[model samples]
Target: MKLKELAHSRTGDKGNISNVSLIVYHLEDYERLRQAVTAERVKNHFKDIVKGEVIRYELPKMGAMNFVMQEALGGGVTRSLSLDRHGKSLSSYLLEMEISLES
Candidate 1:
């Protein structure tokens, strides 16, 4: 299954960093999301765009997680020439990642 099936995402950016949040639709799915969506995996998933570290914050109480990706915006929004300078579409890209939901 795709990550999108389990959660929706939001994104924010500052300088060259993009912060993405994954909020699960239900609390019961949070643990599965945590186990499968590792920082390493996410870094690789956005390897072409993100050039720095991917740090993940666990927010179990909120059934959500936040990922901070550095060196992601081609320098910064105001300076970047990329079509999506603010990286608004990055959350959609992240949600495209495939995950296994095995019992």
Candidate 2:
């Protein structure tokens, strides 16, 4: 499975970096996402494709997980010219992720 299938992503441009914000719905599904798609997992997924920093943030209150992937757009909005693209389509890329339930 791919990360894109597990959550919704929002892509934005900041200076020369691309920021991807991922939100996971259904807390129960988090287990699947965590097990399959971890911080290092994601980094490896985009290692050759994207060149930047990948940060993961867990939001228990919202029952969602956010990922900030930097430098994924080749260079930035100005250089990558991918700002017009929608990040939602990337959901299919994270379908294999596994998340655990809160105790």
User: Which candidate should be chosen as best, given TM-score against the real structure?
Assistant: 1
Model 1: pairs clashing at backbone N, Cα or C within 3 Å = none
Off by over 4 Å in 1: none
- Displacement of residue 33 (Cα, Å) in model 2 is 2.1
**Backbone clash count, each prediction separately:** 0, 27
Write down the TM-score for model 2: 0.63
Instruction: Kindly report which residue stretches of model 2 are placed more than 4 angstroms away from their true locations once superposed.
Output: 1-6, 81-103
RMSD, model 1, all Cα superposed?
0.8
